[model samples]
Target chain A: MMNPISRVAKSLVLLFMFFTLHATAQKITPYLQTTSQVLELPSRVLNETRTIYIHYPKADSTNPNKTYPVLYLMDGESHFEMLSQYTDYLSRWDVNVIPQMIIVGIVNTKRTRDLTPTESIINYFGQPDTSRVSWMKPSGGNERFLQFIREELKPYVDSHYKTQPYNILAGHSFGGLASVYCLLTHPEMFQAYIAVSPSFWWDREYILKLADQKLKKGGSLNKTLFFSDASEGVSDSSTFHTNLLKFDAMLKAKTVIGLRFEYNYYPKETHMTEPMPAFYDALRFIYKAPYK
Target chain B: MMNPISRVAKSLVLLFMFFTLHATAQKITPYLQTTSQVLELPSRVLNETRTIYIHYPKADSTNPNKTYPVLYLMDGESHFEMLSQYTDYLSRWDVNVIPQMIIVGIVNTKRTRDLTPTESIINYFGQPDTSRVSWMKPSGGNERFLQFIREELKPYVDSHYKTQPYNILAGHSFGGLASVYCLLTHPEMFQAYIAVSPSFWWDREYILKLADQKLKKGGSLNKTLFFSDASEGVSDSSTFHTNLLKFDAMLKAKTVIGLRFEYNYYPKETHMTEPMPAFYDALRFIYKAPYK
Candidate 1:
């Protein structure tokens, strides 16, 4: 054999060539074969341009004109890929726990403005002439935001894609708050709602009060809802867990006709980590349907 | 003003152009900004070509040269993206539940042949598989498969990726069988093991028998393991659930030195759906250590 130094150099050259061939020659494709699209939506209601991520079911040869129920998810930037992956996997032919549905992920512009129900400077701890230059100011433009969805986004999505009339609204934290607010103010919007760790303490429980006022006892409101909390505020004042329990109890007491709801508490998970499992379970619960 | 029909036509035209711009002018990036690479690895040990998908942690400007723990996942084609997404999401600055892990997904070729341990044609219901061209004919080549992993795959990964000394092995179903086999036969290959609903029923419980015979009364097989099962066999003969219980009990009784293990039972989930939660829980369990 030749000297060790040259041998090492020669081996490196061969390895480099091998990787070069592997990189360029191989038919490298994305791990997830996604036909997902990013759409730019201009809104007159909010007077701004918004970007939304849309994930549609892979074209099925079996169901050529198959229309899908749409799940409108919030905080698209953080969890769009996640929800896309979950929906794709769970609805696979082999693992058919849930139905194949379209996902419209609404990316954030002014999160605090759009998600909250009231323009209050109040903070999470129940007191605030808050911190100077707090990002939580200019809150609560939910009505105008929903108008954008109702008048513009929904029509656009329905016109562009193959969509069923059935709709599901899903979100976490502030987005969750928006989902609850939508249910109270505009119950006709979605057939199902998933509010994972909703910020229910917003503006002295405005949505909670709205729910109590709007949800008539034994009323004919047909809906499926899944709300959950993970280790948030269970230790101290228990505001988060307590708020969820209060809402659950309120729903039970009302016993609204055709309304189905479930509440799950995750003791181990945190706020940020809860969405993955919560959303999956929500889909499972929502689609457990001889849906109307 | 335009008539209703013309208005509709004009709206459609505008919508088309809007989508065209959204498609063309806008920088529409893939949801998950991935630096993942697909490598075609030719293995001498098994005499087959293997495709491995590698998901690295995104470039950290702060720690540009940082090495990472690698998780070798079987059933690469099925769960690679899930694991990749999980690792990415969990290791995010906001949702810091687990350490960032490099996932090396080994795509299956002859899945049944490679994953099974004993070369027997026995079926799950404790009968000799007598069907014409039973898929279980080429039952066992796990030793050689592990050899391929140890000799070819691991070295390739260590050399190619910015990998730490620590490694984790994860799998489900038959893939789970391979994971347990790797633990028993080649514990040094990985620091942690995840076997989600392992097929202990393989070859009249070959893995269980091996666990019985090989595991000393008080052995020093220091390793971290998380194994779980979902809604399986608990209704009748309970072979699947019982097998897991037996293995769990055996481990506890043996009390192997430095062996930290946990068994989880998910009664609500099915075998096909268990991997999503199990793998997430497994990572949580394994990396709960200030790892050795």
Candidate 2:
């Protein structure tokens, strides 16, 4: 038998030969043509700098003037890639379930500060957290956040990219709350809204009350909204599920004209995992073709 | 009143101001630290160059020698980004459902040639196509394809990356059929297998017969296998769903020792949409903690 060092040397020679062969024949390219860019923009309304991820469809040289709709996503750090992958797959010529659109993922600096619509220190269990460094301390700057989107981010994106006037705002949990809040206050900002497991428990369901007031019976709210809740507080009789039901009932009672809405309850999934399926369903609903 | 040219000029001025302010305050960073690189390796077995997308977890300074399990994904061009997004999200510290694993997505040159096991030119309806340019022609290269993976790709990955012995092979559709075939014939190759919407009707249930023959009754076949079928033939009787049921029943009858298996039926989903949820379920099943 050969010595240990000689055997190792023989293996190295074989490995080198294999690599040499690969090097001669192999050619590699980037797997995805779709590109995402991270840009930090100064938010004059919020008095801060915000980082946003902008993912655009691969350019079509054949159609130079081709413009696409835009989707403004909250909780960019958590769900940007998921939506990007979904939109890319669904919009493929073979899978053509939805049209290709631009995605603007807004990364968070202070989650509670930017996403919450009102200033309150109330915790999830309806208890007030009096701690100095509580996450709820810097609560309620969503109005300014919306202003930043409408004035600064939107203008920049619209000016730089080929985009249609139609837009969709999507979010989850606190972001979901923000989506609902936006729909209630500035319904014209987006043509469609998707709220995945919105935290209706926030500030004693402040947004729910707001929705009750703003959405009058037979109001002309011409927009599509898709909201959902998962297994959160499922063990209890009344919780997020009930809150969603209340909201749904309110919408039904109000009979807002042209306000196309869908409510999905995923009893098996958690708040985190619900977004994977909910977002897909939301897209399909938003892009569902008109009947023959 | 301003004319069109004057309005355009004013808009340009405002845009310039916005850009100047952004340039002063903006900062940009790459969004996804978990970067994937595309590499092409020449396959001596198939006499062709194969492209593979390699996605790795971000480097952890805390544990420089940290290793990960490997997931070999077929139909790379179709589902690479989705799995990459899933693995990254699920393995996050906050959402610690599954451990982070390196994903090697093998892109197709000749898809049917590499994925199908047998050389028959049978269509989806079990009819033989005698056409010269049939996609089914130049088939039955799966064994050689497996040889390329086992001999060329896995060795390259093992040598290069910090990897654990635990590995998984995942595929969908034809790729899914390939995953099942691999699990049945070459059990030692992967510790786990995931087949999402596998095409069981391939060559009139070739793999089903193989599985029945190879998996002996009460034999020691230590592995984890998760197979699923969606709403294919839901409008009719006895199709992919029935095929899955037959496979599941065979497993039950044989009672293979050390084999952990689960079958999921997604009637609400289609062949394409099934992977989005099935993959998530598969990961959860694979990493489920023991019951109390």
Question: What DockQ does every candidate get?
Answer: 0.26, 0.39
How far out, in Å, is residue A139 in model 1?
A: 0.7
Q: Please, what are the lDDT tens digits per residue for candidate 2 over residues B1-292? A: 9999999999999999988876787666555435788988877787877889999887778889999999999999888888888888877777666788899999999989899999888887778999989978888878888989999899989987999999999999999999999998898999999999888888899999999899999899999999999888674554678888999999999999999999999987768778888988888788775311
**Candidate 2 deviant stretches above 4 angstroms:** A1-33, A235-238, A289-292, B1-33, B235-238, B290-292
Worst 10 residues of 2 chain B by lDDT: B26-35
Which candidate number would show the highest TM-score if scored against the true structure?
Answer: 1
Q: How many backbone clashes does candidate 2 have?
A: 0
Least well predicted 10-residue stretch by lDDT in candidate 2 chain A: A25-34
Best-fitting candidate, measured by lDDT?
A: 2
Summarize candidate 1's per-residue lDDT along B47-143 as a digit string, tens digits.
7678989888888899988889999999999998889989999888798877888999999989998899889888887788887799997879988
Please list all clashing residue pairs in model 2, or write none if there are none. Answer: none
State the local distance difference test value for candidate 2.
Answer: 0.87
